[model samples]
Target: MNLKRFCTRFREMRTCYVGTQVSFLDKIFYVVDYVGAFIVHGASISDYFAYGFYKLRYNGRKEYITYRRYHIIQDKCNVLSNRCLCREKNKFNELFKNFLGRAWIDVNDVTEEQFILFCNQHPILFVKETNGYRGIGTRKIETKKQDVKQIYADLVSDKGAHYIVEEQISQIQDLAEFHPWSINTIRIVTIYDTLNDQVHIMNARLRMGNKKNSVDNFHFEGIGANINIETGIIDTVGYDTHNNTYITHPLTGKQVIGFKIPYWEDCKSFVVKVAKNIPTVRYIGWDIVIQEGGNFVLIEGNDNADHDFQQLHNCGLWKQYKSIIKYF
Candidate 1:
């Protein structure tokens, strides 16, 4: 958004345009189409052309419709900082306390003695910043070896007072086979229609972390694939941030397609219920992990739901919801 950043990005856009595979006319069309979308969304031209040249293949129509332009509208609709409720992990779990088990404690509120006592109960735990994003400020705690006081002290020093000590979730074996080291999560985006007072499952994708990482965030060098909303099947193999596709997981050799998510219907139903519960926050991106026994737990929620995953699916987001999104 600043002058330096803007210049750097514009330079990158021109570089990408030089390397694009599309014809000159097609590239011109892509640029013109993006200029129009920019008028509507004010998105950076660099990102638009970069995505268009590489991923969308200079297809102006898909570039126009698929690139999300609804954030301002979403913020206007979700007037209250109800969106911020989920931004803080402690407040998120507290708001939906009935849906989750007692698996967390605020590190700031407890003494070192009490924290150790709680840690001893679980072999593994996760110390996280209550309001972190993109899997940042998260530390995996192995209770067997690490000293609780040291871990607590480091967390408090690094993240200050607002952090949480949470029990590590065990992802379902079926899903874990793709990347055993990480707890992969399903990202479901839901939109609440204020006119109808109803919620809609806009889109979803399975986000898997690399074998080396513990957190499964799309931004953390992880992979994601589209999920068939109706069938609960993954539509394609995982793709990384670079837009490189994979038919099978590089580390685990697990087949991505035809893999049906466990407790699919239950996850959908529960997310819908949660969405309806938060009336003030109409649009939400829900991250959830399926347990070993086919049950699922809500990992976190995002009110600023971007269409990055949807863009990878090679479909225009607005094509399907033109009537509703026109208001934006």
Candidate 2:
């Protein structure tokens, strides 16, 4: 048994049950999952499960790199199969900044002063690590102060600290028009359907963040809901066992209820356009923000998006995306 290799692989295997099921291999060297899921990925799994994915193997040399999230994201969704080099979003955001136009908060070389100034002007801001996920290092800076430097220090100190500070955009004219703190984001997913060699939008989710919620990620402590793609209305919502939830605003006691996502169509179009630009990545997740005036803005792009939020809720998108397992 190659104990060292087994132990190393065990640490990286995300699913806890997977660890237990395969742990004996560590002692016996059975080489449990050498040729497992097409997309070998690390994700936010409860101790119960971790997701694995991959496209059907074809060709002689190799179709995609092993666990290369950037490479997979850069894959072509078309027959020509053109690709891009910026696997990382900070660079992707920078390279595409001039293309994204003036409305986007200019974020090339970020400075503490510029970030604070923008937050002060915009009322709310989103700070995110470019190469990170699960809302692990995200902070919604609502107010700025001279002590903003400390927050910046803490944020950028993490491993993948390369970040983009964006002005927070709300999604409603009035929450009372639907429900209190009704503003939210829609997660649109596009997958390269390998069986048919086509691209299709698998699912879209609406994530709502109230005043008390730091981030609306369905993982790492945020509230989310499944959205009906065509109607842009939330089919079901509220917190799950993993992401947590509340019946009323825990702080204000305002009720949460059925609400439509603002500017849904435009958000979908932009996601398709940018994913087309990336080309190769078969699966793409786009998080879009809606301004109070109901204008849609692209918040950021996620290459390997967590879709478990789809499954745990039994939102029923598994079959829609299963064929796209070209393992991106």
TM-score of each: 0.85, 0.59
lDDT of 1 by residue, 145-260 (tens): 98877887776676445898888777788888889889899999887776687778888899888857988788888988889899999987788866567888888888877788
Question: For candidate 2, lDDT tens digit of each residue in 55-107?
Answer: 12233113222334323333433232222223355665665563332232434
Candidate 2 segments whose C-alpha is farther than 4 A from its true place: 1-89, 95-126, 140-144, 147-160, 174-183, 192-199, 243-258, 324-328
Q: Highest TM-score: which candidate? A: 1
Mind sharing the TM-score for model 1?
0.85
**Global lDDT of model 2:** 0.51
Give each prediction's root-mean-square deviation over alpha carbons: 3.5, 8.2
* CA lDDT, candidate 2, residue 151: 62
Worst window of 10 by summed lDDT in candidate 2? 47-56
lDDT of each: 0.75, 0.51
The top-ranked prediction according to lDDT is 1
Pairs clashing within candidate 1? none
